[model samples]
Target chain A: MKATPARDQETVDKWEVQLRKGCLELAILAALWEGKLYGLEILRQLESDSDLIVSEGTVYPLLSRLKVLGLVKSEWVESEAGHPRKYYALTPAGKKRALEMAGIWTRFSSSMGKLLAPLGKGNK
Target chain B: MTMADDVQQRDAQQSMEAYLGRLRRRLRGMNDEDAREIVEELRSHIRDKAAASGQVTASGVDAALAALGSPEELASQYLTDDLLARAEVSRSPVRILESLFRWASLSVAGFLVLLGSMVGYFLGVVFILVAALKSFHPRTAGVWVLPNGADDFNISVRLGFGSAPLEGREVLGWWIMPIGLAAGCALVMLTTRFAIWCVRQYRKSRALPRG
Candidate 1:
């Protein structure tokens, strides 16, 4: 007996989910690297810049966790159109973490790219 | 504004409130102020998301809520994250275990830490109990290194009945009380410190899906 393609795809999806979970902290930290942004703005930055589409509810808990770790800080500012919005900014520690994460990601992905280079050619 | 848009706005408001209501219910046992603040922040996020889409239609609200995912899961993540953060600093055994048990539900590292914690605390408790029983049942409730063979031995610590189960001499007759008490308290204190250190490490390493 052999596994189906769907099963293989399921395994890949599981890996994808875990990978995303691992990168979420780094991603949020990176999103706040430029300056303060409200929750929705952060989500939009993640989507537009990185093409990573995270579910909306996931970001809040993650932000809370970052604040607990002293990596990020937040404050509420009045919005002209609606309710006051909570804006998140990277703390000094968060900026340091973001730089460290970026370096790691760059190194990891570059090697990953080298490993994956052959598969892209389809020469075999 | 058209009457149709008015109706859609009202429906959107209802759906958002209903979602928040379920979230508030899930957060009931949490600190009221913290829970209220969470609800407030989420309310603002949802409204901000909906309004930013250029229309406050029911579908816009639906999209916002959908992006946010289920309120139940969201609330649980918030609770677990808060618990683990508090557990890192809290010195109380009950509070630490409460946090660890919840963490255990989510990760293997947490379960292992919790198992270590339980075993450490259990031994500490056993030592204290043996110390107390030394006064009541001096014949049985004490620690000893009973000789098992000519070259080997067994270290035994127990709370028993009748006569002592050992042929070898007891470790510390009446002095066992104060020694046991001190040793038990020390064990407990050391376990607490070790558990806190383990939790801090776990928090540092395990940074994914606080749910």
Candidate 2:
């Protein structure tokens, strides 16, 4: 690893945190783009697919909010193994919103990549 | 030994119960039914996560609990989120203020909105009081235009306790009652609306302001 100042690293960490906070909703919604899943399943999916780790505590409350906004709906499904699991699925409005967000994200990332192209070349 | 494993297993169960107990206590003030539902759901999640690890040890369960953060923290998040959702659909001042108080714990924006509402409501009450008290003390319970005070000329609202000020002129006569009542009601209404507007704007994003 290259030597870097701790303060610089802290600043980078803060920006990454900000980025993660903004994308968390999209990430959760995208995870449900497949099908209904329980809380732990969502967590595992995010962990396996991306480095966008979140404290597990934040997920359920967010799911509740999404429900309130009519973006998602949940149901209690009985399980043979243990207690019933609460499975959440995106609603029609949620799917529409996710598509719109994904479009915006695609354009924004390409723009950012183009802007950073010079930096990449300089590093080489 | 089997005995040691039994002790560890008992300890693990106790830890989980203790954690759930703390969570239940923190979830107070929310509807009992809703709070109980949340706690049970969380309880299930913890059990499932812990079981997935294939160990029943205290450390294993604790790890699962830790992944969910502290009981208080999770409870507060749930409370804030619930309050905000309710506040969105509700026009009740009491309910809105309750939600703002919950949000105030997390963000500077929320704290400021709550403060503004409190100050507005306080002033509204004071205005109504001044108006109501005017009927009782017509002589002094009106707006006073003191041309000169100990420092500068001061305009004040007084309830006329002992003496109407030595040289201060009482303005508005009987009109003060109507003015005070109207102004009081207006302040209360304006404050409520402003607070609700702020709540609506901030509700879309719950992340704390740049810290």
Candidate 2 steric clashes: 0
Model 2 segments more than 4 A misplaced: A1-5, B1-3, B90-92, B100-117, B124-149, B152-211
TM-score of chain B of 1: 0.65
Q: Compared with the true structure, what per-residue lDDT tens digits does model 1 show for residues A1-124?
A: 8989999998887677678777888988988888999888887888888746776767787788788778899888998876788888998988999999999999999999999998999976
Pairs in clash, predicted candidate 1: A56-B67, A57-B68
Model 2 chain A is weakest, by summed lDDT over 10 consecutive residues, at A13-22
Off by over 4 Å in 1: A1-3, B2-4, B87-92, B100-211
Q: Write the per-residue lDDT of candidate 2 for residues B1-57, one digit (tens) a residue.
A: 599889988888888999989988877767788778777778778878877866567
When superposed on Cα atoms, how far off is each prediction in RMSD?
6.4, 5.4
Worst 10 residues of 1 chain A by lDDT: A50-59
TM-score of chain A of each: 0.92, 0.91
